[model samples]
Target: MNEYKIEDLLFEELILMDQEASDYEDLITQIGELAFEKGYVDKEFSKAVIEREKLYPTGLPTNKVKVAIPHAMVRDNVKKSAIIISKLKKPVLFKEMGSSTDSFIPVDIVFLLAVNGSKDQLTILQKLVGMFSDDDAMVKLNDMKTASDTIGVLKEILSQ
Candidate 1:
């Protein structure tokens, strides 16, 4: 596996307050704005995010934990990027990607992913999946309350 730097693999701009009125559109706008501020995406990044969300819902079914993986296509707006993990106090409902059923997935942890390429993106996602799969890592991640704390945990995990 290709090793990534802590700064390169994680986005700190994920720290935000999303209200109950905030839908997927609002979430995408917030993430897109952060991506733009970080110079990882263009001004039109929100459009790409919405398009990607429409096609592939990034809601993962977590039996043991509460997490969501929200990603988008990298062709238009993304340059260099990482996963922006946000811990929400309340669960948000998202439709499952490629599924027709009315099943809505409730998620507390959101991983807003911005990638430069399709193949490279999957690799990053796999790394995160592996990291989160570790019982110890999940515990450490969930225990974190602040952005700095979360970033510290992510840095430690990536370094390992």
Candidate 2:
């Protein structure tokens, strides 16, 4: 398996707003626009993001370290890629994948995955899951309050 480095995949282009929005719709819209502005997405990318979220929820369950992975097809957008990390002040409700019930996940970390396709996206996802699966790494990420701090922690994890 290819070891995906979150830092290499992330940069200032991936850092977005840190405040919480009223709802998922607004949150997704704001993040999608930022992705587009950074050349990671296209004009219609917002619609795709919403549609993808409706089909496959990206929220992951955790007690201390909550996160969400929102992603869509690159064909619907551009060839360039990015992974945005946002720290929200409040929790958001997202549907669980393969299930009808929704989960009120207190997601302080949001990883907006922008990839080319299933293969590359899956690779990135695997690395992300593997890296964050460690309780220590998750704690470090949760404690991070700034984009630079978060990126630094991710880089350290990638180096290991």
Candidate 3:
């Protein structure tokens, strides 16, 4: 079995769609509130992620899909750790990581992330990035209608 299970990292309460946000902070606030309500992290998580993202944007534009894996080192503020997967109702502009000119692009799929430790975060992130790099996986992930479906796909991929 995989040491890190996607099912364990993902939860029904953390999956959401049909949210509308005009900017980065707006979306992070909405995501952070849900995670806070579920007792995964504190209210400061949103601010932390927003601040971190400004310095290190996580927007990844793939051949199949566009995504942003937003996260923070919120060890001081985190109560627990969980990952939130969401699809925005509309694409929001985010600065690309390592961009010299500060270019920005629209990102629709976002992975709002939290992890208890650096080791755990690295393990989970590696699994997620490898999976998301697959064209088929990204297509299916974008097509998922429910959280269960998303979990199922990740479970299947990560279990390999």
TM-score of each: 0.82, 0.87, 0.91
Against the reference, the lDDT scores of all candidates come to 0.70, 0.73, 0.81
Task: Arrange candidates by TM-score, descending.
Answer: 3, 2, 1
CA RMSD per model (angstroms): 2.6, 2.3, 1.9
Candidate 1: worst 10 consecutive residues by lDDT? 12-21
Model 1 regions more than 4 Å off: 1-7, 17-21
Model 2 regions lying over 4 Å from their true place: 1-5
Clashes of each: 0, 0, 0
For candidate 2, what is the lDDT? 0.73
Candidate ordering by lDDT (highest first): 3, 2, 1
Candidate with best lDDT: 3
What are the per-residue Cα lDDT tens digits for candidate 2 across 8-50?
A: 6788656754668876667778888877777777877777877
The global Cα lDDT (0 to 1) of model 1 is 0.70
Tens-digit lDDT track of model 3 for 5-100: 555887877888667987988998899998998899888889999999988998876668778888996666677777898887888888886788
